[model samples]
Target chain A: MASTTEILEKILTSPPSAPQGIAYNYLVPNIRGLETMVKTLQVKGAQASGYPTPAASPQSEQSPTSTSASNSSEISLFAAATETFSQKNTNCSIAESLERCKPIMELAKQNNIRVRGYVSVALGCPYEGPDVDPHKVAEITATLLEMGCDEVSVADTTGMGTAPRTQKLLQTLKEAGILEEDLALHFHDTYGMALVNTVVGLEHGVRIFDSSVGGLGGCPYSNVATEDLIHLLHSLGCETGVDMVKMAEIGDWITKELNRPDDSRAGKATLARIKG
Target chain B: MASTTEILEKILTSPPSAPQGIAYNYLVPNIRGLETMVKTLQVKGAQASGYPTPAASPQSEQSPTSTSASNSSEISLFAAATETFSQKNTNCSIAESLERCKPIMELAKQNNIRVRGYVSVALGCPYEGPDVDPHKVAEITATLLEMGCDEVSVADTTGMGTAPRTQKLLQTLKEAGILEEDLALHFHDTYGMALVNTVVGLEHGVRIFDSSVGGLGGCPYSNVATEDLIHLLHSLGCETGVDMVKMAEIGDWITKELNRPDDSRAGKATLARIKG
Candidate 1:
């Protein structure tokens, strides 16, 4: 199997000729993962003696000189919404987790990488009741933004979200002076409220959303299932620039690859209809 | 195991005194289920001999004098949005399913019972691609209404819905002269779009919604999961009149009785927090 770095490099270096823009995003779970990705890029540069005949046609090709213009870098860091969940999920207190991300965020900035902050259990924490203090969520969000983070994504990791809770969270954020543009909503469909939460977010002027393809990802602690994020986006009027058919195909492919059942309800229904 | 009719009667009688000003609607899946319910009610009446001290001053005592006067008899009939799904789910074609429902609706009306209609697979058919024609859905709605359905519920059975698709579907209904008030939106949390679809429905002026407690009922064919409807309603600032604590307790009880894992994300999280 290819190492994580090798995989990232392969995806990154594989001629940017595909019609799809940015087909892959790698998650760096720790500092080591980030180091691996950066090292892979360096090794690729050293190995490539000369530009091998632009892998494919460059439609809007600028000069070959711009090839070295540093690629935009982005990384994500996460904190839980409640102290109990924060401790359980990240093995650190909420404040401690935030403290841990300080160096990570600073390092990313030094390397010219934009850091996206994530606050998990925003709507309801698995270890805490649904009565998560909106003030606490807001305070944590402000701390992240002040810590030089580009944007923050609020995550309902347990999918225990409802429209009222989502609305209140957004209201709290607004009161905290966090503009809609500075936020993204990440929802788990464990209880089927993810899409509804998305709509509420949109009504509040939020545009960016974070979703997994085929509703992948499970609550490591709670063992809840979630719907695919892409499906939710497609249902909304906003254009995600992702091809639904292609996404369904990739969802099927990955499920088979992982030896897991295809988790996307939309993808399965679509494929069934087509096959029938 | 108790027969479906027996189970329904138990539900009706155990509650004893119906709540004042609240209407209790029961579901009879087929002709037999309906007949059994009627028989049970008649038997209970005969056994009553006379009104011997009404059980605990019936919840809705001011509404009417007799059970028949106060009780609004209504049952639900369901069909799928797609022909293939209709056939597989109900063992009949769309036309045949509608034909079958005609008698049921007529019978209910004759007995002064209202009939509520449901069209499953509304957003995306499990056996049909996302290209479900809105015209077809409209035609079905018209047919059900013509057959004397007091209200129609459009269900996203597979949970393959988004804001755009829901908006488009609602527009079609509006154009077809189906007032938003005459329609209810039923969505599954299969892909976490149920709540989002609900928001879209609300934007379209829909007030009625169909949701299962604890998000019970998985798609037999699609195997997709849905969110607890009551939870979604509570989250959206809508008054479902359901006790969240009671509902959560019921969710836990049902999950245990069914020998199925608790499928509710909210229920589980709430339970965890309370236990902690």
Candidate 2:
């Protein structure tokens, strides 16, 4: 975790003329992690104001203080939609997990930072069967919204979602007064429904979607991640703010680095086309 | 091969009310296979006309005789658009393969059977690469048509075709005086672009397509079959005369039988919805 933070900082500081922004993830495993992040932000702010480095150009100088400000103001937290998965993943029941997040949400409010909440296992659960009630999903979503989350992302962790189920789930959420803009969908392509599910989401007016670079993350149960969603989004005429060429290159690089088969259909195809 | 043939015949005969049709694949590895099929058809036709079994319904007895009478008039053949693949797969150079096919085509003409030509590796080849000259594809297509093929199916055996490439290829074929009605498309989804490529083909006014049940075949190099083309066609409001439910069930059954994961996106999604 610390190495990742350091690498992020190095990347941000390398280019003086580049427009860099800080993304704060609140994995607040406990209250200690949250406090540590707050303290780190304060220390960084003070250090940037006191010691101005030559590498910090005029534009970068103005952005230096803003980085800490932005980092302090935006944080992301996640909870699972089903109690079984929430308890298993977070070591707490769904209610207890929400309670655990109370302090983090309060801290974000105190600091005037926006909090983004995630509801994992929205489509189906590995532990539980496939009959995920959309009403239960709506209840959890309502709770997160009431807790002051600016937006909530629903994830199909097991990649068991289909187009009709996804559409039905979205309709239920809409009926519960959660507009489509307040929702983001994350799909795993374990069974190749990620793209179709994303299309269903788009038809329901969803815009923001969560996709990992090179489809990095995988479900512990199914051991699959959402790889086809990016290509599907591109086909739907949506801009993803991702450089597909670089993304494909990185996909190949990382698969080689990790000694795993490149799981991405688009990545493999693009490589084949470019190589040919 | 014998076991597969038996299983196919059992499935066809046991389903008393099922629609019966012959796929009649054109690309035989050699003339020996063609002769075997021709002999089988001849014997079957004679037996059906000589004595209709009590087990065979009136509909079945009449249908087979007429079907074989119509089918006995034609045979299908295949040629590759690229030279490297043609030599590698067919064990003959393009010119040699064409010369070899002449006798087969002549036999078909003598039998009064209409011949259908398939141009494999038309979109791209893993060995020779993606810059398969459209002119070469057109020339092969025209040659096949001139050789008495009633129609041609252009294939993307490597599954490396993209929308633009497919569009350009189709445009070239159209410009070469090949009507879209006489052209069919065969795409492999090595890169998850098969459906989109199909959409491009649809826009180009090509209608006939070749798709495997459950996307059964996988490419050796690319490792993914072009599966979701049927679902995409259905989504686009095109009628394919296929029962989606039956197709999904067959896809699931075949995947289970092969001990391989079900690769069809539509099949998986539909089954998931049904189960959920």
Candidate topping DockQ: 1
For residue B126, model 1's alpha carbon misses the true position, in angstroms, by 6.0
Model 1: how far is A18 from its true place, Å? Answer: 9.4
Count clashes in each candidate, considering only residues at least 3 apart in sequence or on different chains.
14, 6
Q: What class would a CAPRI assessor give candidate 2's docking?
A: incorrect
lDDT of 1 by residue, A1-276 (tens): 998666677655654444323434455567777777667656756766642323333564655543443233467888888999877767888899888888777767776667888888888776676788888999999999999989998988877777788899999999999989989888776655666677688889999877665555665432222235555555555577776667778878887888875656667655655675
* Model 1: lDDT of residue B225: 21
Candidate 2 DockQ vs. native? 0.21
Cα RMSD (Å) per model?
7.1, 8.2
Instruction: Write one digit per residue (lDDT tens) for candidate 2, span A122-147.
Output: 88887785568888888888899999
lDDT of 2 by residue, B1-276 (tens): 555344333333332232343444444456675575556555555665542222435666655443432112345687988888887888888878777777888766765657788888888876788779888999888888888778888988877676778888999999999999889888776766676677678889999877776677655533233335556666556787777777888888987998876667667766765676
Clashes of 2: 6
Supply DockQ values for each candidate.
Answer: 0.39, 0.21
What residue pairs clash in candidate 2, if any at all? Answer: A73-A113, B73-B112, B73-B113, B74-B113, B74-B114, B189-B226
